[model samples]
Target: MLQTRVIIILLIVLNIFHETTAYIFDVNYSYKYSTKKTVYSSVFLQQNKKDFRFLAGAPKTDNILICNTTVCKSFAFSSQNEAGFEMLGAAIAAGNTVGDPTYICAPHYIVLPSFRINGRCFALHENFKPIYSLDNRLQQVKAYNGSYEFYYAQGQVGFSAKYVEDNEFLLGAPGVLSWKGTVIKHTDLNIKNILQPEKVAEKNSYLGYAIEFGEYYFGGRKRRCAIGGAPRGDNLLGQVSLI
Candidate 1:
């Protein structure tokens, strides 16, 4: 009976291995883009019905490439043609559906004249054209008397982002407030910064490393909330905060 059980287990293992190998070896389509010094560090894949599209970030060139089955097109912010302003495609986010608005971020963007390192993000139209910039650098700098004193207060606004609903999303600035991190809620008519009330004397917690939206029940009523991750929080052990 033991011998029979061993044979059955061996057969099952062999079957599973065969299926895995077959799936691994199967390839339907592949695409590659050549670049001189740029690396496709971040990528996003979107699908609609039966069509697939891909978006790749090229930080070195400060550009993004959007590709379909046939061709890939490059995009850049024409007005922001300055050096050291890389990280254009560091973060990308869109809604679950195909027709939803898409956002591309440059987390290290530098404001001119003052050279303040306030990050910027853009919302793209369906044709991949930038509709408007969600920049609060002027207002933020004004609050600090026209200059940022510390590195953490610079407000690298677009380090991370997540889409919640129509014309609404969350933007992360993991460098704000001594790296404790902050999230900005962007709506059609308002932009609000959400900061942690309790201050951590130590720096570099990076609370907004990632973000998402969740729904829960409170008093039997459904409530939606924002969640963020701080991988360096709690003495480098990490923590997730619900907002």
Candidate 2:
């Protein structure tokens, strides 16, 4: 019996490997201790990448699907549009099938010059527009959505910061710089600098955030820092100080 079980497990492992490896791109990502199985390869003209899907769900009910190319849910044949992607994400989140393709899409907020250790920077405005502001010697840009506002600053100090609308979350700033008009009510804010600005941040001098949520292929295949708040809402909200 023991020998039989061992052989069965080995076979299953080999089968999974074979199935996944059969595709041109295979990436096993871990989210919240759960592994996301992605297997496929195609080009998303918008993203210019091979097919890839981020699956979220249990084995049998594995319904949540996020694919870049024509792999999992085809919102439109050979078209990886934002509307389709948002529909797919919402469908999975609501545990429902694809609905009206014209449904109001949710904006994926990304404050560039990301606060994540080694992330990109941008000068987005409150309305998601790209605007530039200079103060004395410090210059900054901002972008905002329903939940948070993000900024990228350069001059005496260089860093990124966020102001979230969620309650009980706050990121205090050091006395090094002024926060005269950047503060938002009932929001958490934090800032960090680009580890290597010259390479990644400097490359994209745009004032707005990237439209997609995937790895940043620029600078030779570097992954973009993760946006959004805590995975589980229960996680503690901590602050990062510049001092």
Candidate 3:
């Protein structure tokens, strides 16, 4: 009798597990948005006063889709005259709270005239309208052989981004300095690179491939730090740095 009871309980548990797995794998309950071969790349959710919005990046078209419960609207890049300015929605980040600004990045955006490939990011207002670009538009001029040449950021900025605080964020440029990578700390008043290649051997390490902020205990005290991932560091063994 004891053995028979144990068998009945085991059969009941197995039946439950089978039903749960079948439900999870059912395709009839899923929703399909696009039939094209485009990647919906990045996604973000924003909350307004009482409503929520869904934002998706469509890199193939250089556009962003802002969706509510009812419909989705497309917003195209404002500056399209520059050649090779692609991948507008490669990265997306939002402010800490609702109604805060939204950031959208295009890691392949090319600067005109000089044709620099520093990439660009747009800051959207609370209403999802672009306020301005976060990248500095200044270009350094150099005199070479009696001719003037313009130089801008060629580090491929906007490959990754994260919101830190009010009017502050971090941007990644994995292509900077022969793919050694670097992270930029941007605030309302200034923007500067916080990560640099410490040695020539660090090249191709890709230090700023990803980043995040977290709190950790050190010396029995809690401290906040920015963490960066170098997936190709140390002969592809990968490394994580804290700042």
C-alpha local distance difference test of each model:
0.72, 0.25, 0.72
Candidate 1: segments with Cα more than 4 A from true spot: 4-26, 29-36, 79-83, 126-153, 197-202, 216-221
Per-residue alpha-carbon lDDT of candidate 1 for residues 187-218, written as tens digits (9 for 90 to 100): 77987777551354346878777888879988
lDDT of 2 by residue, 92-120 (tens): 11111222111111122112333211111
**TM-score: model 1 vs. ground truth:** 0.78
Ten-residue region with minimum lDDT total, candidate 2: 100-109
Comparing 1 with 3 on TM-score, the higher-scoring candidate is 1
**Candidate 2 overall Cα lDDT vs. reference?**
0.25
> TM-score of each candidate?
0.78, 0.18, 0.76
Over the stretch 1-243, how does candidate 3's per-residue lDDT look in tens digits? 999999999999999998888764568664445535556888887786777777789877788888777677778766664586468888887764566767888888776786667777778764344423323555433343477543234666778888777778888777666577777787778877786544425768777778888789999999978887889988889988787
Ranking according to lDDT, highest score first: 1, 3, 2
